[model samples]
Target: MLTLTENAAIAVKAVVAGTPDVQAAGIRIRGAEAPTAGFELTLAPQPEPADAVVEADGARVFLDSTAQAALDDQVLDAQMNEDGSVRFALAAQA
Candidate 1:
């Protein structure tokens, strides 16, 4: 199973709510691929920058059976340079 940071969850909820297109499209979670291990963090509308937002919730992200990988038991964070974008690297459940 996957979990979301409190702040990250809030942030994502807000973003999804605001994103008219995505909101209407319906955001979801899944694995990036068939991880040899377990999970492999994945999502639709591909989050830009792949991990770089504010608030711990900024790290909050979505995942599916496909996206969940053995992410070191936690969501690894990433960010972009030009803009402070946010995304999560979900590890599979061990």
Candidate 2:
């Protein structure tokens, strides 16, 4: 189950709606790779903005076919920070 915060969803929708150079972007709640088991992740970076978003709404979303299992219990959220960087973190999916 994927659960997105209301604020996060709003922020994501607004950003993805107007940005053009942003090939794609999305919050990534990914699991640790090789030799690791617990989950931890960073926001997927976008082609357009690097400093503004913690995660980019990029090809990651489309690649779900390949990575869905890894992202199974994740959530996507958007946050407004005074620092101006979009924040992302792992959460218990409902």
- C-alpha TM-scores of all predictions: 0.38, 0.46
Q: For model 2, how does the per-residue alpha-carbon lDDT over 36-61 read when each residue is reduced to its tens digit?
A: 57554434545223222333332233
Error of 2 at 4 (Å): 1.1
- Can you give the lDDT of residue 62 in candidate 1? 44
Error of 1 at 18 (Å): 2.2
- Evaluate model 2: give its TM-score: 0.46
TM-score of 1: 0.38
lDDT (Cα, 0-100) at 84 in candidate 1: 40
Per-model lDDT: 0.43, 0.47
For candidate 1, the per-residue lDDT at 69 reads: 40
6-25 in candidate 1: lDDT tens per residue?
54564455556555465422
Give the range of the ten consecutive residues with the poorest summed lDDT in model 2.
Answer: 57-66
